[model samples]
Target chain A: EADIYQTPRYLVIGTGKKITLECSQTMGHDKMYWYQQDPGMELHLIHYSYGVNSTEKGDLSSESTVSRIRTEHFPLTLESARPSHTSQYLCASSEGQGRNTEAFFGQGTRLTVV
Target chain B: QQPVQSPQAVILREGEDAVINCSSSKALYSVHWYRQKHGEAPVFLMILLKGGEQKGHEKISASFNEKKQQSSLYLTASQLSYSGTYFCGTEMRGGGSQGNLIFGKGTKLSVKP
Candidate 1:
């Protein structure tokens, strides 16, 4: 099993509340990513980091922001949550050069903004 | 660009077989296959790099065609545990060192016992 873990496997909060989704991996992978997925839908990349202090926005635009101050942690935060932001967020990490590597994923956090 | 997957959904009986195909419009450096069960994160099945390589894991196998910029996943003797959504992620040749993956919409596979 993958060593990656996400906190608050499920969350339901009121609108306008600030929330943070935590992701941590013990694999010491340099590449980490956050993806948003709706029920039974494809995953959309929201943010990714190549390494510590190197973050990039993915193809899909997202209001949430992520930080990678530590190699093993990549947490995503929402300034103010909205119902529109309600979706499952998945965290993944891959070792070696990103080119030919396979990503291992966490269990994912299911966010439900009310 | 995101890869395109054919046969949005498929249904099969236990012990049957199925094939899922993914195609990219741009040249690809690699193709990755992942399976996501209900209410869970996607699990990586395998990754196929350039050179038209083929990889297999137990009853699951995949083939990559570099020239066609396409990849196919084959599941023989499907099991109920194989019921899930399958996604194909493509990494473009010039997608940078990070090799960010752009995924297809996904194909849902349902296996009935």
Candidate 2:
């Protein structure tokens, strides 16, 4: 389908549990981002990767960490999940720069922390 | 930096037109638009670069003004399908490889048939 995919469409976990949300792109994009969005609220960038071995924290300081070992895979991990971390995680990827470079988003992973 | 979107929420009737504006204090390289339905992921609408050009996706068109550091999305002949939250994402030059796109609070649009 030439799109981005996020695994575990929905997750419900206990507090202090380690978890990882997987995101993969089949479009071979170089840029990938992880955004945290609460229901009907604004989206906050948590983490992003430019390319392989390149990752950076986003505008929103997050307790979660991300890795970009491959061009297509960008996964977000939390050492200890908390109720504060409960939110929808969205994954997006872009090809290049400028107006032509539009980002494609995945369906998103809705996580509920208890 | 995050852009600011005006008219946080709007209600329109079918066939009516609505304009949602996005403004940023910082200069922008490009502005991207997306529409997200309730309980669904956002869908890309269009991208307007700094050149002050206009782009349209489906019935939605957007314009970017470099001088004003703002972008406006026009929804002409609104339909029930147009009911969703509209978000404007701004991308500035030289922010590392991610080119991170910062989004505004978004404008929620409700279209009634």
Candidate 3:
């Protein structure tokens, strides 16, 4: 099993609520990513980080923000959540920019905004 | 560019054979294959480098054609455990996009007894 972990496997909250999805990895990888996936759909990259204090937006436009002050933790925060933000958030970590490197994913957090 | 996957889905019986194809419009650095079951994270199957090499894991095999910018995954004598959504992630050959995978919509495979 991968050493990555995501807290609150499942979450439910009201609209306009602020929430943070926590992701941590013990693999000591430098590349980490956040992907949003709807049930039974393709995975969409939302955010990623190269290393500490480095973050970038992905192909998908998301209202959520992330910070990587530490090497092992990358947490995504939604200042004001909405029903449209309800989806599965997956955290993945990879070692480098090598052409053959594979990413390890966490269990994922299922968020529901009512 | 996002690679396009063919046959969006396929259903097979145990011991049957199936193939999933992925093609990209842009030059590829490599190809990554992953399988994800419902309510779970995706599992890496294998990676096909730009050299157009073929890799196999148990009964699953994949071939990449760099010149053609295409890849094909072969599943021989499929097992029930192989049932899941198969996704092909493409790494385009260019600047600013390294290590980040642009994934296909995915192809759902179902294996029945």
Candidate 4:
């Protein structure tokens, strides 16, 4: 099915190491977003993009950053991973139509900073 | 801003009905419902637009109130498969710029057969 995909479904890394979580979609949706969540907790928006070449910070201040070099690709990178950054990262995309335009989510990447 | 979901968690018996409520502080253009099982991604349930509109599939449905900034999800004849955490996300009028939906903490529903 045409959907969003995230790589390395699970990641365990050491502190101070750099890592990038990959997110890609084949839907050609113009808007993409990244959300962080602890188990069974509220999802916090970390980063988002309106389209290719456009990226912005979300409501939650994140130590990681994202890049939208292509319309289908929006990858998040942490300069230096920390234990505080350990959480499940979810990637989603939306179409700017209808009052109820719902976003589609990826399987998510669970990062454990050891 | 993040929306608030009521009845943080609920336990139901199979074939029973349950209601989950979500309220936002700001005016909502639309509201979305999703369900997440243990160790799984959230799956779309339904989306209710403004102006007292509603939409649903199967036994799950939802309603949206633009004025009150509230939305409710109704699950009828619940099944064991309905056991999951439900979340409501709200989109505001001027929020299209960010293309992001503020999500509620989520309501955990356990359906015992």
Q: Report the TM-score of candidate 1, chain B only.
A: 0.92
On lDDT, the candidate that comes out on top is: 3
Assess every candidate by TM-score: 0.94, 0.95, 0.95, 0.94
Off by over 4 Å in 1: B52-56, B95-98
Which ranges in model 3 have alpha carbons more than 4 Å from their true place? B52-56
lDDT accuracy of residue A80 in candidate 1: 99
- What are the Cα lDDT values of the candidates? 0.89, 0.88, 0.90, 0.87
Instruction: Give the winner by lDDT: 2 or 4.
Output: 2
Which residue pairs show collisions in model 1? none
Model 2: lDDT of residue B43: 84
Candidate 2 CAPRI-style tier: medium
List model 1 lDDT by residue over B1-113, tens digit each: 88999889999999999999999989888899999989878888888989756443656788898999989998999999999999999878873523777789999999998
The CA lDDT at A17 in model 1 is 99
Which DockQ values do the candidates obtain, in the order shown? 0.80, 0.78, 0.75, 0.71
- Identify the superior model by DockQ, candidate 1 or candidate 2: 1
Interface RMS for model 4: 1.5
Give the candidates in order of lDDT, highest first: 3, 1, 2, 4
Give the clashing residue pairs of candidate 2, or none: none
Model 3, position B1: C-alpha lDDT score: 72
The CAPRI-style docking tier of model 3 reads medium
- i-RMS for every candidate (Å) is 0.9, 1.1, 1.1, 1.5
Tens-digit lDDT string for candidate 1 (A19-113): 99999999989889999999999989899888899888988999999999999999999999999999999999887463468888999999999
Worst 10 residues of 1 chain A by lDDT: A94-103
